[model samples]
Target: MAIEEKRAWIMAVVTIVAYGTYLALVLNAAAGAPLGEAPYVYAMLWTIGGAIVAAILLNILAAIVSPRDGGKKDQRDKEINRLGEHIGQSFVILGAVLALLFAITGLAAFWIANVIYLAFVLSSILGSIAKIVAYRRGFQSW
Candidate 1:
Protein backbone atom coordinates (compact mmCIF):
# COMPACT_ATOMS: atom_id res chain seq x y z
CA MET A 1 0.00 0.00 0.00
CA ALA A 2 1.08 3.54 -0.60
CA ILE A 3 2.23 5.51 2.41
CA GLU A 4 -0.75 7.83 1.98
CA GLU A 5 -3.08 4.87 2.09
CA LYS A 6 -1.41 3.62 5.24
CA ARG A 7 -1.75 7.05 6.74
CA ALA A 8 -5.43 7.11 5.87
CA TRP A 9 -5.97 3.80 7.58
CA ILE A 10 -4.12 5.02 10.62
CA MET A 11 -6.18 8.20 10.73
CA ALA A 12 -9.48 6.38 10.44
CA VAL A 13 -8.66 3.82 13.11
CA VAL A 14 -7.13 6.35 15.49
CA THR A 15 -10.04 8.74 15.15
CA ILE A 16 -12.52 5.98 15.92
CA VAL A 17 -10.58 4.70 18.89
CA ALA A 18 -9.94 8.12 20.37
CA TYR A 19 -13.53 9.27 19.96
CA GLY A 20 -14.82 5.98 21.27
CA THR A 21 -12.61 6.31 24.32
CA TYR A 22 -13.87 9.82 24.91
CA LEU A 23 -17.49 8.77 24.56
CA ALA A 24 -17.01 5.94 27.02
CA LEU A 25 -15.39 8.18 29.59
CA VAL A 26 -17.97 10.93 29.24
CA LEU A 27 -20.94 8.59 29.37
CA ASN A 28 -19.55 6.76 32.35
CA ALA A 29 -19.05 10.00 34.19
CA ALA A 30 -22.58 11.18 33.40
CA ALA A 31 -23.85 8.44 35.78
CA GLY A 32 -27.55 8.90 34.98
CA ALA A 33 -27.43 12.66 35.14
CA PRO A 34 -28.35 14.63 32.05
CA LEU A 35 -25.65 14.47 29.37
CA GLY A 36 -25.48 18.23 29.43
CA GLU A 37 -24.44 18.09 33.06
CA ALA A 38 -21.54 15.71 32.49
CA PRO A 39 -18.04 17.11 32.55
CA TYR A 40 -17.42 16.77 28.82
CA VAL A 41 -15.25 19.72 27.94
CA TYR A 42 -12.16 18.35 29.61
CA ALA A 43 -12.71 14.89 28.23
CA MET A 44 -13.27 16.22 24.72
CA LEU A 45 -10.22 18.40 24.87
CA TRP A 46 -8.06 15.61 26.18
CA THR A 47 -9.29 13.18 23.58
CA ILE A 48 -8.70 15.66 20.78
CA GLY A 49 -5.23 16.36 22.04
CA GLY A 50 -4.48 12.70 22.51
CA ALA A 51 -5.71 11.92 19.03
CA ILE A 52 -3.39 14.52 17.52
CA VAL A 53 -0.43 13.17 19.44
CA ALA A 54 -1.24 9.60 18.61
CA ALA A 55 -1.69 10.38 14.93
CA ILE A 56 1.66 12.09 14.76
CA LEU A 57 3.41 9.25 16.56
CA LEU A 58 1.75 6.61 14.47
CA ASN A 59 2.52 8.44 11.23
CA ILE A 60 6.13 8.58 12.26
CA LEU A 61 6.03 4.87 12.94
CA ALA A 62 4.45 4.24 9.58
CA ALA A 63 7.17 6.23 7.86
CA ILE A 64 9.88 4.33 9.70
CA VAL A 65 8.24 1.04 8.80
CA SER A 66 8.10 1.95 5.11
CA PRO A 67 11.23 3.99 4.60
CA ARG A 68 11.13 3.25 0.91
CA ASP A 69 7.84 5.12 0.44
CA GLY A 70 9.56 8.24 1.69
CA GLY A 71 6.19 9.97 2.15
CA LYS A 72 5.99 10.94 -1.46
CA LYS A 73 2.88 12.48 -3.02
CA ASP A 74 2.25 12.56 -6.74
CA GLN A 75 -0.64 13.74 -8.88
CA ARG A 76 -2.83 10.85 -7.95
CA ASP A 77 -2.24 11.45 -4.28
CA LYS A 78 -3.18 15.09 -4.66
CA GLU A 79 -6.30 14.31 -6.60
CA ILE A 80 -7.37 11.63 -4.18
CA ASN A 81 -6.82 13.93 -1.27
CA ARG A 82 -8.86 16.67 -2.88
CA LEU A 83 -11.65 14.30 -3.66
CA GLY A 84 -11.66 12.86 -0.18
CA GLU A 85 -11.75 16.29 1.40
CA HIS A 86 -14.57 17.35 -0.86
CA ILE A 87 -16.55 14.30 0.12
CA GLY A 88 -15.82 14.66 3.81
CA GLN A 89 -16.59 18.35 4.12
CA SER A 90 -20.28 17.74 3.62
CA PHE A 91 -20.58 16.50 7.16
CA VAL A 92 -19.06 19.68 8.50
CA ILE A 93 -21.75 21.76 6.83
CA LEU A 94 -24.37 19.41 8.08
CA GLY A 95 -23.06 19.63 11.60
CA ALA A 96 -22.89 23.40 11.49
CA VAL A 97 -26.48 23.62 10.30
CA LEU A 98 -27.62 21.24 12.99
CA ALA A 99 -25.71 23.15 15.64
CA LEU A 100 -27.36 26.34 14.47
CA LEU A 101 -30.75 24.71 14.69
CA PHE A 102 -29.94 23.44 18.17
CA ALA A 103 -28.91 26.90 19.22
CA ILE A 104 -32.11 28.41 17.83
CA THR A 105 -34.08 25.77 19.67
CA GLY A 106 -32.35 26.56 22.95
CA LEU A 107 -30.69 23.19 23.23
CA ALA A 108 -27.88 22.77 25.71
CA ALA A 109 -24.42 23.99 24.81
CA PHE A 110 -23.20 20.49 25.43
CA TRP A 111 -25.28 19.16 22.55
CA ILE A 112 -24.07 21.82 20.19
CA ALA A 113 -20.44 21.24 21.06
CA ASN A 114 -20.79 17.49 20.87
CA VAL A 115 -22.51 17.73 17.52
CA ILE A 116 -19.68 19.78 16.13
CA TYR A 117 -17.12 17.38 17.51
CA LEU A 118 -18.98 14.42 16.10
CA ALA A 119 -19.03 16.15 12.73
CA PHE A 120 -15.27 16.54 12.82
CA VAL A 121 -14.83 12.89 13.71
CA LEU A 122 -17.17 11.83 10.96
CA SER A 123 -15.31 14.00 8.48
CA SER A 124 -12.00 12.46 9.40
CA ILE A 125 -13.30 8.91 9.14
CA LEU A 126 -15.12 9.49 5.86
CA GLY A 127 -12.21 11.34 4.36
CA SER A 128 -9.80 8.62 5.28
CA ILE A 129 -12.12 5.99 3.92
CA ALA A 130 -12.38 7.85 0.64
CA LYS A 131 -8.64 8.10 0.33
CA ILE A 132 -8.15 4.46 1.17
CA VAL A 133 -10.80 3.37 -1.29
CA ALA A 134 -9.36 5.54 -4.02
CA TYR A 135 -5.91 4.13 -3.43
CA ARG A 136 -7.14 0.54 -3.53
CA ARG A 137 -9.67 0.79 -6.35
CA GLY A 138 -8.16 3.55 -8.46
CA PHE A 139 -9.40 7.09 -8.47
CA GLN A 140 -11.76 8.18 -11.18
CA SER A 141 -11.18 11.38 -13.07
CA TRP A 142 -14.47 13.11 -13.78
Candidate 2:
Protein backbone atom coordinates (compact mmCIF):
# COMPACT_ATOMS: atom_id res chain seq x y z
CA MET A 1 0.00 0.00 0.00
CA ALA A 2 1.05 3.58 -0.53
CA ILE A 3 2.10 5.82 2.31
CA GLU A 4 -1.07 7.84 1.97
CA GLU A 5 -3.14 4.68 2.08
CA LYS A 6 -1.46 3.55 5.27
CA ARG A 7 -1.98 6.92 6.86
CA ALA A 8 -5.60 6.95 5.86
CA TRP A 9 -6.24 3.48 7.27
CA ILE A 10 -4.63 4.42 10.53
CA MET A 11 -6.68 7.61 10.81
CA ALA A 12 -9.90 5.86 9.88
CA VAL A 13 -9.39 3.10 12.43
CA VAL A 14 -8.55 5.54 15.18
CA THR A 15 -11.54 7.74 14.46
CA ILE A 16 -13.88 4.77 14.43
CA VAL A 17 -12.62 3.58 17.79
CA ALA A 18 -12.89 7.04 19.31
CA TYR A 19 -16.39 7.59 18.01
CA GLY A 20 -17.45 4.20 19.27
CA THR A 21 -16.15 5.04 22.71
CA TYR A 22 -18.04 8.32 22.69
CA LEU A 23 -21.24 6.58 21.75
CA ALA A 24 -20.78 3.98 24.44
CA LEU A 25 -20.13 6.59 27.09
CA VAL A 26 -23.15 8.62 26.10
CA LEU A 27 -25.39 5.61 26.17
CA ASN A 28 -24.10 4.54 29.55
CA ALA A 29 -24.60 8.00 30.95
CA ALA A 30 -28.15 8.04 29.71
CA ALA A 31 -28.66 4.77 31.55
CA GLY A 32 -27.77 6.47 34.86
CA ALA A 33 -24.17 5.32 34.99
CA PRO A 34 -21.86 7.52 36.99
CA LEU A 35 -19.12 9.25 35.01
CA GLY A 36 -17.06 9.91 38.21
CA GLU A 37 -17.37 13.67 37.66
CA ALA A 38 -20.07 14.95 35.34
CA PRO A 39 -21.44 13.30 32.27
CA TYR A 40 -20.41 15.83 29.64
CA VAL A 41 -17.22 16.89 31.34
CA TYR A 42 -15.69 13.45 31.64
CA ALA A 43 -16.97 12.43 28.27
CA MET A 44 -15.34 15.41 26.62
CA LEU A 45 -12.04 14.74 28.32
CA TRP A 46 -12.12 11.09 27.40
CA THR A 47 -12.92 11.77 23.79
CA ILE A 48 -10.20 14.38 23.41
CA GLY A 49 -7.60 12.25 25.09
CA GLY A 50 -8.49 9.26 22.95
CA ALA A 51 -8.07 11.25 19.80
CA ILE A 52 -4.73 12.66 20.86
CA VAL A 53 -3.29 9.36 21.95
CA ALA A 54 -4.60 7.57 18.91
CA ALA A 55 -2.97 10.03 16.53
CA ILE A 56 0.35 10.04 18.33
CA LEU A 57 0.66 6.30 18.62
CA LEU A 58 -0.50 5.58 15.11
CA ASN A 59 1.73 8.20 13.54
CA ILE A 60 4.70 6.95 15.49
CA LEU A 61 4.03 3.40 14.43
CA ALA A 62 3.65 4.35 10.82
CA ALA A 63 6.85 6.35 10.85
CA ILE A 64 8.69 3.43 12.35
CA VAL A 65 7.31 1.01 9.83
CA SER A 66 7.99 3.19 6.82
CA PRO A 67 11.05 5.25 7.54
CA ARG A 68 11.03 6.44 3.95
CA ASP A 69 7.63 8.04 4.57
CA GLY A 70 8.75 10.99 6.62
CA GLY A 71 6.05 12.50 8.75
CA LYS A 72 6.38 15.77 6.91
CA LYS A 73 3.05 16.08 5.15
CA ASP A 74 3.41 16.87 1.46
CA GLN A 75 1.24 19.35 -0.40
CA ARG A 76 -1.42 16.77 -1.11
CA ASP A 77 -1.51 15.70 2.49
CA LYS A 78 -1.67 19.30 3.56
CA GLU A 79 -4.59 19.93 1.28
CA ILE A 80 -6.42 16.90 2.64
CA ASN A 81 -5.91 18.21 6.14
CA ARG A 82 -7.17 21.62 5.07
CA LEU A 83 -10.28 20.07 3.64
CA GLY A 84 -10.83 18.18 6.86
CA GLU A 85 -10.51 21.39 8.84
CA HIS A 86 -12.97 23.09 6.53
CA ILE A 87 -15.47 20.35 7.25
CA GLY A 88 -14.77 20.69 10.94
CA GLN A 89 -15.32 24.44 10.79
CA SER A 90 -18.61 23.88 9.03
CA PHE A 91 -19.68 21.63 11.85
CA VAL A 92 -18.58 24.22 14.34
CA ILE A 93 -20.72 26.79 12.60
CA LEU A 94 -23.70 24.46 12.70
CA GLY A 95 -23.13 23.81 16.36
CA ALA A 96 -22.87 27.51 17.09
CA VAL A 97 -26.05 28.29 15.23
CA LEU A 98 -27.88 25.59 17.11
CA ALA A 99 -26.59 26.93 20.36
CA LEU A 100 -27.59 30.49 19.47
CA LEU A 101 -31.05 29.53 18.28
CA PHE A 102 -31.59 27.45 21.39
CA ALA A 103 -30.58 30.34 23.61
CA ILE A 104 -32.72 32.86 21.75
CA THR A 105 -35.74 30.60 21.72
CA GLY A 106 -35.21 29.30 25.23
CA LEU A 107 -35.43 25.76 23.93
CA ALA A 108 -31.96 24.41 24.50
CA ALA A 109 -31.34 22.65 27.75
CA PHE A 110 -27.86 22.04 29.13
CA TRP A 111 -28.02 18.48 27.92
CA ILE A 112 -29.12 19.72 24.54
CA ALA A 113 -26.11 21.98 24.33
CA ASN A 114 -23.90 19.11 25.34
CA VAL A 115 -25.36 16.93 22.63
CA ILE A 116 -24.91 19.63 20.03
CA TYR A 117 -21.28 20.03 21.01
CA LEU A 118 -20.80 16.30 20.79
CA ALA A 119 -22.35 16.39 17.36
CA PHE A 120 -19.65 18.78 16.24
CA VAL A 121 -17.02 16.68 17.88
CA LEU A 122 -18.22 13.59 16.10
CA SER A 123 -18.39 15.42 12.82
CA SER A 124 -14.80 16.55 13.20
CA ILE A 125 -13.71 12.99 13.80
CA LEU A 126 -15.62 11.85 10.74
CA GLY A 127 -14.26 14.68 8.66
CA SER A 128 -10.72 13.67 9.42
CA ILE A 129 -11.58 10.11 8.57
CA ALA A 130 -13.10 11.21 5.27
CA LYS A 131 -10.05 13.23 4.33
CA ILE A 132 -7.83 10.29 5.04
CA VAL A 133 -10.03 8.10 2.91
CA ALA A 134 -9.76 10.59 0.10
CA TYR A 135 -6.01 10.58 0.34
CA ARG A 136 -5.88 6.81 0.28
CA ARG A 137 -8.26 6.66 -2.67
CA GLY A 138 -5.96 8.99 -4.63
CA PHE A 139 -8.14 12.04 -4.44
CA GLN A 140 -5.26 14.43 -4.27
CA SER A 141 -5.37 18.19 -3.95
CA TRP A 142 -8.22 19.20 -6.20
In candidate 1, residue 103 scores what lDDT? 100
lDDT of 2 at 79: 76
User: How would you encode candidate 1's per-residue C-alpha lDDT over 1-142 as one tens digit per residue?
Assistant: 8899999999999999999999999999999998899999999999999999999999999999999999998989899999989989999999999999999999999999999999999999999999999999888879
Query: How many clashing pairs per prediction, in order?
Result: 0, 0
Worst 10-residue lDDT window for candidate 1 reads 133-142
Candidate 1 off by > 4 Å: none
Error of 1 at 16 (Å): 0.2
lDDT of 2: 0.68
**Considering summed lDDT, which 10 consecutive residues are worst modelled in model 2?**
32-41
lDDT (Cα, tens digit) per residue for candidate 2, span 1-142: 5465576667666767776787687777767654333355676568768887987888778888988767666777777777777776777777777777877877636555565756666666767677766765667564
Residue pairs clashing, model 2: none
Model 1 deviation from the true structure expressed as Cα RMSD, one decimal place: 0.9
